[model samples]
Target: MYSPLVQPAVSGASSGSRESTRDNVLNSVLTHGPVSAATIGDQLQLTAAAVRRHLDSLEKDGLVEVKSVAGSRGAGRPSRRYVVTQQGQSHLGDDYLDLASEAVRLLQEISGDEAIRSLARKHFASLEQRFSELVPEDADLTDRIRALTRTLDEAGFAASTRRAGRGGKVTTLRAAQICQGHCPIQEMAGEFPEFCEEETELFARLLEVDVRRLSTLPTGGHVCTTHVPLGRRAHASLMAHTAQRAEK
Candidate 1:
C-alpha cells in the first residue's frame, strides 16, 4: 500500500545531515506540490535555516523550482512556494536505474573498469539471489516456469504462455519499451545476456525437464525468445508438494 500523504515518513538521519535534509525537502515538495519552505519546515520538523540550505541544494540539482505568489490579502513580500520538477519525480521510486547508472559511472570514473566489473558481478549475484526467493518451495517444473513467467511479467516483461501440446507449454515474453528506454547496460542484452540464460537454467533445474529457447521475436527494436518445455503433467505433484513444504 502506498501512502496518500504529501511525503513518505523519514526513517533515520541522512548523510551529512544537510544532504539528507535537502533530499527530504525536495521529496516533500515533489510529493505534495507547490508549498512554502516554512510549511515544508513544519512538516519535516526542520529549522527554517536547515530547510533553506536543503532547498538550495535541490535547486542546484535542477530538481526543485520555486514560484513566487502574493500571500492572501497582499502581504508585505510575496511567498516563494517550492515544487518538484520532472527530474525530481524520477528519483522518487525504487525503479530509479538512471540514478544507479550515474552512481556506477561515478564509481567507474574513479575506480576504473576492473572495479566496476567486480561491482557489477557482485550486484548481479545479489539480484539473482533475490529473484530466486520468488520460487515456491517444492513447486514442480511447469508451475515453477509459470511462476517465473509471472515474475518476468511483473518485471516489465510482457509474458504470455500457450499450450503447445498435451504435455508442452511455450512461454513468450516481450520486454516493455519503457524499461528499455531507461536501461543503462547496453539496454538489457549486453548488461544481462545471462539473464535469460539463468532463467532457462532455473526452469530446467526446478522442473527437471529440458527447457529450450526458440527463435527470436521482435520486441521494441531488439529480439527475444520463447521458453518451451516438451511435456506437460511431468510435475503433477508440484503444488501439493509445495503445500506440504509450507506446512513443514
Candidate 2:
C-alpha cells in the first residue's frame, strides 16, 4: 500500500525531454511541500500556466496531490497546494533495501531473535567507536556530541541538538527523521533476520554510531534508534545543527 519515496532523476536540458521538467517540478514540491502553484512557478522561473501543465501531468500519474487550502484570517479564496505523493517518493531512489531484507529473512529462519540482536549491537557499537575516535580528546562533552551529530547529518539523518534543564543541561541531539527509501534492501531488512542484521551493521559503519534495534530500544514499535551524545562543545558542533534546523 505504502511505498518508500524515490529520489529525483537528473535532467539535462539538451536531452529534449519533458520528463526532466516534470522531474524538476516534482523535486520542487518535495523540498517545499504543500506549496501553491504560483509559488512553485515563481521559484522555478516557470509561468503559472507552465506550472499548471506540469502539475496536470503529475496529478494524472498519481505522483502528487492538489488540495485547496481555505484562506486563513481575512485571506481571500482558497488556493490549491501541491504535495508529492508516497508513490512518487518511492521512485526517488535505487532500491537497495530489497536485497538486505531478503538476507535478514533468511537469517531469522535459521538463527532467531537473540542472534540477530547480538549482531545488531556489535554493529551499533562499531559505529559509535569510529565516530568517537574522530572526536577530539581535549574537547568537552558538548564538542564531542556536536561532532557526532554533524557526522550523522552528513550521513542523511535529519539530526539536531538542544540544551535542556538547568545549567544549560546537556546538549541533546535528536534525529528527527531518517531517509531510508534508497537504502539497499530496506524493506527486506525489516522483514528478515539476516537482512536486518546486515542493514544494522551497514548503518553503523556508514554513520559511525551504534544503531539499536527498535525492539531493544524504548522506541516502542519504531524500527530503530541511533544515539549521538551531546555534552561537550566538540559534540555540540554535531548537535548544534539541531538548533540551526529548529530556527529554520
Candidate 3:
C-alpha cells in the first residue's frame, strides 16, 4: 500500500531530526559544560531520555567525557556530569586558528601591540564593509539588525536577534539584543580583546546606533550579547519604513 512507501520516508526524516538534535546537544555541552544531563535538558527543553541518547552517542564518538560527582550527604550514589573532550574542543576550533595565532605572534614580535591592534581593526573593517553592503541605504534599524545577524550567521558566529526591554517589543522599547552563540576566534580573543573591541565598533558603524557588548564567549559567558538602543523618536518612522520595504 501507499503507507508502506511513506513509512520509510517518515522514519528517515525522524532519524535526520534526531541527528540534528544530537549536534545541538554537543554544542550545548561545548558552551556550558561540565554540566549534568538534566541541566542540559533544562536549557534545551529536551526530555531526559532524549538528552541521554545524544550523550551516549557523543561518548561513543569520543567527543564527550563523563565524571562522577559526589552527591549530598546521605543521598544516593554520585551524579554523572559530562564535559567536552579535547577532540570535541578541536572540532569547534576554526581550521585556520593555528595560522592566525602564528600571524598575530609574528606581528607582535616584529612590530608591537599597536601593530596587532591596527591589524585587528583592519580585519574587522573588511567584515564591516562586506556586511554593510547587504543592507539598503534607506533600511531602518530592524532591517539593519536582521542583515547583520544573517551576515554573522553566515560567518559561523551563529548570531541571532531578539526584542529586549520592559515591554518585550522593539517598537515599544526601541532596543534589541544581538546574541552570538559561537565565536571562531574565542581563544585568540581572550588574549587580545582588541578583536572584540574592534568588532563592536564595526557593529556600531554598520547599524548607526549606539551598541554595548554585555558579554562574550571569551569572557566565559554562554553567548556574546550586544545591546542596541534604537532611540524612541525614530521608532515609528523606522517601523513604517521597514513595513514599506517588506511589501516591496
Clashes of each: 3, 53, 0
lDDT of 2 by residue, 1-248 (tens): 11112323444333476777787887666544556888767666777887788899998998788767787575898878886665665565536556655665576679886656555555445446666676765665445445555544344432233332334443344322232212222343335345345544444333433434433111221123333222322234434543342232
Estimated TM-score per prediction?
Answer: 0.34, 0.46, 0.64
- On a 0 to 100 scale, what is the lDDT of residue 65 in model 3? 82
| Rank by TM-score (best first) | 3, 2, 1
- Expressed as tens digits, the lDDT of each residue in 14-102 for candidate 3 is 56588767777887665445568997787667788888988999999998889787885858998897866656655776688878888
**Model 2: lowest-lDDT 10 consecutive positions:** 215-224
Q: In candidate 1, what are the lDDT values of residues 1-248, reduced to their tens digit?
A: 11221234562345557566666676566444456888777778877877787788888887777878798799678889786554554444436565666776687689876655455545445434544686667776555555555544444333334444332234333111111111123233234344345444444444455456553221222223444554433353654543342232
The segments of candidate 3 whose C-alpha lies over 4 angstroms from its true place after superposition are 1-21, 24-52, 55-89, 168-174, 232-248
RMSD of 2: 10.3
Q: Quote model 3's TM-score.
A: 0.64
Question: Which 10 successive residues of model 1 have the least lDDT summed?
Answer: 174-183
True lDDT of residue 187, candidate 3: 77
Stretches of candidate 1 off by over 4 Å are 1-7, 10-18, 93-248
